[model samples]
Target chain A: MADEKIKSPKIQATEQMKQLITEYYIDAKTTKLPEGSHKPICWITSGGPVEFLIAADVIPIYPENHGAMCGAARIAPGLAEVAEKMGFSRDLCSYARADIGGALTESGAIPGGLPKPDFLLCCNNICGTVVKWYEELARIFDVPMFLFDTPFIHVEKPEHATEYVRQQCLELVKFLEERTGSGFSLERFAEVAMLSVEAVDLWKGVLATAESRPSPFTCFDAFIHMAPIVTLRGTQKVVDYYKLLKKEMEDRVAQGVGAVHDEKYRLIWDNIPIWYEMRNLGNLFAENRACLVADTYTTAWAVDIRIEDPLTSMADAYTKVYLNISIDIMLEQLVELMERYEADGLVMHSNRSCKPYSLGQYDLSRAVAERTGKPSLIIEADMTDSRVYSEAQTRERVEAFIESL
Target chain B: MPVAGVDIGSLTAKAVVLQGREVLSTSLTQTGHNSRVAGRRALDMALDRMGLDEGSLGFIVATGYGRTAADFAGERITEITCHARGANRTHPEARTVIDLGGQDSKAIAIDERGKVLDFVMNDKCSAGTGRFLEVMASALEVELDDLGSLSLESTSPASISSVCTVFAESEVVSRVAEGAPKVDIIAGIHQAIASRIYAMAARIPTNEALIITGGVARNIGVVRALEQKFDTRIVVPEMPQHMGALGAAIIAGEHHE
Candidate 1:
């Protein structure tokens, strides 16, 4: 007999969010045409300073987001193989491989691939791989590139490192002015930075709703809803979307609704999601009565961008991102999240494609357990590469972990 | 009322039948292509030994790689939990369990009541598992049962370095060609498995008294090597392969009430 699976009710805002993403992509794709918006398209890293581009009236494109799209669409492995055949090592980040392979093949989740970039923006705060990934893209498209270096924070963000990043923010402004053939506007940047802060605050508010018992949404929901926060952070559209998302979450919480049916355990997820397995993982957890109420990935965007001094605050906020900090600091943040979310346990993805995120996970797992007396399960798999994933093995581990909880 | 537990592993199927706290009978059989059939056969054999039939069982819990295939099971649980419960039952002092099964190996940390605290398993790799040793034994032209006793006779064990099963098999073949003693090669294979398991098992706290369970626990050479690596005496419960089935049976009894 086929078992009746108890699925979490679909969030009402998903269709609206999808439509918003479609419109964002359509707007980005049209900007490349001579008769279109005529706005210069800058391919930026997921952690790049997109607010500057917004202020400069240039359309920002995120290849990392596009890589995630391909992954969710289940076409990443095929695309990544193309790059592997082109002599790129399989050990390279799957995101880079998928994006590069999509560019060469002109096939992806989106037709005709992402519109060509007039310029490339690379940030090392996320990982060192993006530096080379963007360099390759710049060479391929024969475009100017901006490299923003954020030094790793061992204990705290040093004044010199912050100043160094702050100086780069200035140079980034000049770079934007030169590329767009327009003058830099501090007034415009200030307005964009304020909107960026407001959107991020709303995003945090949306995520915080998970603190309620029988959380309104899971981290899988957050991963989907986070698209606007990552892609269009400085715009009013992002602010409006998150406000709507937050309200829906509040209503769900007030109604005592949960993302998982009969939510028995609340888990905190660590690291980037396995994009291809998101739906399956979500269903598997929900079936076991575990709700992944929070995660470190989506909350990476929740960093406060103080608008008091736009450039300095941007420098500090971008430099001290979740990935760029020391393990000790990451642990503190993780422990805090566990307590705030009232998590029953933690699930960490030991992502093969991401070294910085995956490294020190074992230590962090041990530390978190010691601090919170909560068990942690580490699953080894690549974020975008399905080849590295073993379905039977992963299921067994997850089931066993849930049983332990 | 009698309760039963069926463990459908990749290589074997095991079943344990119990009434109250006492084990009535146990059975083991090779798991061929169809796991559901193997599960039923194992359970039936155990029941037949006790002169009881399927209807006699009050509850049936299933476990292992093919646990879900046993549709007759009242509950399906992972082999990790089963092994921990089984180990704790056999050796109540067991706080840590290293289960080396056919296709996978796992290190589990359990509480006083045998509830799992944390666990780590080999990631999609065949190294440090029973299958790895089976491949090496076949490559050495030695019987699987003789591998443990044969390795004990070697004074200087050959060094087999490859972690991949296929590569390690080739390494053993080359050692055989180079006139290395079969005993030494076999001993080296055990050492390699021990080292790989040690590296993974070290991630979790290895609180003694540590116990080894699963099909691989039947191999004395691997147990000795693990003892040397962990620097602790390891307990091997009687009928090590039946631990998961035994644990499932115990859980079945719990669920019956």
Candidate 2:
């Protein structure tokens, strides 16, 4: 028994996606005017309107993604320490701390730091912290900063809210045009919007394949492969990549091959992942023959986007994101996900870095338990900072939850 | 067939042997630095007392923080599930369990069949745990066993605002410097732990039939404080620390089927 081997089946597409992301970064890093480059680089939030930026031929960069890389490399806390020493509150979001620390220190997991942003994009749809986080970057860099404010959705999407967000989408185009010294092209935007829509649809298809009994791929695989959808969503490459991923998942489902060797209980995860402990968590659940089939975090990439009237739809889509809604809406979504996936339980990550996501999880967990008659486990930890994690405590909670199931 | 259960906790290792529904023997020892050594020693002691060898046992189960480290048991289960099972086997009507171990505290809600329905645990901290009491005992220059009774003598317990063990120690030092009565300070520490546990326990749908288990349950001061805070009578088992091992043995007996 001691010699028994436990192996989590590797997703075949990750190796190719890793190479693809590396090349994409190298291209963004090496781009310069010396080589007759005219594309402007803009540092955007993860939930920013990247399709419009892509349509205007501007390169978009997500610092939050870089923060995840720093976490994986285990340099996030050291980098956050730099920012904290500079008087930034340790209570600030770790992603914000890591990004601010990386900017000031000009060093990170990637050599020479991220390419200097020609402009900045801020969206409050994800969290209010980004408003201050981006303001600091703008203060230091002295660049044009655009703020897209999407009010929280409480009961329903009011007409005034949609109108307000639609106006900002138009103003956003004008802001980008003025900064880049170019005019917005309707034809170009139509192509990019359609590609973005197709990419999102493919991503939805990829996640839906997990509804199979022994999921073809776990959410851990989705967390890694989700980069292209976040970074390259409005491009043809993203559409092509997801098509390949969806086909592979289809084959796995047909072959009855699961992410874990023996899949017993299927669980749905809420909130962002513990990036530093992904492999550890994956192995932990896999060892118990429990597969995390779906999660709320990665589903943000597939928010309903209408291509017919892309700008107006963008207004509603970006405003109604999971984090920007009320607990009632979140509970509704949780119930839908639970039924759709037939999950045995839910695991809520009470992330220290994300207040908006973690604030109402207790209520949400209770609601989920009542609605689905399934257990939900709340494990406290930070997404990027390993310092907040207690392995022994988390292990006991997870083991007991699995044993009860 | 006789079955054995071993619980290797952070601070103690306990073993229990059962023949049918009767507990044949039980043993407890400090876990020391090596949990596997402590586990073997405790289990051997219990088996020796019962005049039984390893070959006589039908199955063995392990539980607690050091459970996986033992590597000798046929199966491992978490203390949360085991505590509920063990409490149910003894009380038969226990719907809730509050377990305050050496390093962590948890509240488990169980159904009629001893199946865990819901639960909540303290954030990874020593607050509201046995370790917290030990630190306060040393800081106040009192014995760990005497802390409970000392607190009982105080009419006005000095207020302890800090729930963190480290901060609470410094607070105790400052109080001692201010010449506050030692009995009052000890009572305050128990109140703080009881309040913390009560708040965590409130998260689950608790019932009147509640059982408090683990090594800390032997502290009457904590039990009294919890009774005051929760306004409910608390039940303490005869061998509180052995519940996890006893539950595991109960499970081992069932494994034969």
Candidate 3:
């Protein structure tokens, strides 16, 4: 009884892709890439395999980056519906669902505008979501899946992990050398390893822009800018990108321009953003002259900590990252950031989409402000799905709070 | 013959003293770690506003995530029931209630007589909630009150993807990295939140007589974004944030009869 003229092309394309994923395209590994100059397409995480991929000239794509794109485009909703249709619960994190679902519905259930991968690489730095996501993708596509297994860190990383992951790094190098026509770039990597480290120093500087009384930018920008590091870390380009970003921040600060109206306060924000409303949130903050000084992402970058030699030091550092460890360690890191940034207060976001990250936030919030003498505020909401946010009420409470401060 | 209501939420409690349909007084504060302390604090604050005591002649009701936690109250009602009653009283024609609280966002459909029909709630993520805005507000160094007004000035907006509050922190940091304008980021957050709210309301049959309640209703910026998306006038009580509490008291009064 509905008008057929109103049908959407986007929906039609999705239907076509679902059919293709269900049918024709066989895993190409059964037949090798046309034995030419073309390199094997590789899937990369924020950490793992970046140096090795570049050494072998393998084209790299970060799945997390794709996941973000799906969210920004509101593509997560449809993909999430597809995942739910496949029996995944609606309550599952939409980021995870959209990533998997987008892959299924994208240009026929493949990464749209992306080359078919010859190999897949992921690490144990971030969360279990990445591992499971890659596992399913590998199973569906039938490609070689290589996991850069980093040992779990609770209190502190054990000494054995250093040698273990380092040896794995070397193994990674050999794997790439055999697959590609290029030789093992040992000296190049030693150089690349150190180069990657310096980028961190620059990244930290760029992040420092948030310290401005009226921060020139916001946390969402950092999330966008982190893509190059995920995709091009070892390459000189990633380092160059950070340098340029740092320069812009310096310029913003020098002009005395407020990211918000008259940044009279500095606050630290906890948790991820609601992708559905990143732009609006930032503008609202700018009008108040409040700037975010530090956040948890400063640690996510530890995923790609450069190893001095594919044999030592670097892998150990990667394994020790705050994210690879326990909440207690994250707490320690939180204390460090709050103190280092000299922030007046803390804003804790109790996000429902990611239960793990937000689980202990209330306790942590209490501890940070009570134990450390910093003012703390806790707000609850969802990050991706728009169904969760209430702007007017939030505005009222926060305004009164700031004025009170 | 004005009636009053008090709503105590998980994080904060509110008291909106109503005289008939007009708001006489309203107050807000943290709920503390325990709900009892929070509930008492809220009640006392409302009493203080009215220059009266707990031994008043009117009715009393309690509502919110911590409705049952309000042990001293004469009556208890679900936030849904309280919201319906309050919204109906605010705009007699309101067919829908969109209430965004500190921890949850809800969309309710009501019949012409203020009877509840269908409702949806997003209690899962902090991304689309006030918590998300609070985080970004802290990061941007902006006063919370100025957030809604300043965000309207930004020409360009930033895209924030992390649905988890934890990861969104990383995203906001990255925004700072790229030199994206702070106001733009805040504005984007408001839009993101509004989109979530509108989508939920759309799921159930809705009409122009929409009412918004909860503590977040005070944010003008969120109201603007929601208005643009819903494409209809939004009816909010003078003390929109305390409608839940007010409804609770009204219910208690009726029940006492």
lDDT of each: 0.92, 0.91, 0.67
Relative to the unseen true structure, what is the C-alpha lDDT of residue B198 in candidate 3, on a scale of 0 to 100? Answer: 82
lDDT (Cα, tens digit) per residue for candidate 2, span A1-405 = 211344555778888798878877887888767768646989999999899899998889889999999998889999999899999987899999999999988878779888888899999999999999999999878887999999999999999999999999999999989988889998999899899999999999999999998899888899999999998898998898899999999999999988877799999999888988988888889889899999999999897778788888989999999999999999998899989999999999999999999998988888888888998999999999888889988999999999989
List model 3 lDDT by residue over B109-161, tens digit each: 78776666655566456656666777778888888778988888878867875
Report i-RMS for every model: 0.7, 0.7, 13.4
Q: Distance from true position, residue A28, model 1, in Å? A: 2.0
For this target, which candidate reaches the highest lDDT against the unseen true structure? 1
Tens digit per residue, CA lDDT, model 1, B1-257: 99999999989999999888788999999999999999999999999998899998899999998887899999999999999999988888999999999999999999888999889999889998888888887788788989999999999999999988988988988999999999999999999999999999899888769999999999999999999899899999999999999999999999999
Query: Which of candidates 1 and 3 is the stronger one according to TM-score?
Result: 1
For model 3 the local lDDT of residue A71 reads: 58
lDDT of 2 at A43: 93
The DockQ of each candidate is: 0.87, 0.87, 0.04
Query: What DockQ would you assign to candidate 2?
Result: 0.87
Error of 3 at A6 (Å): 40
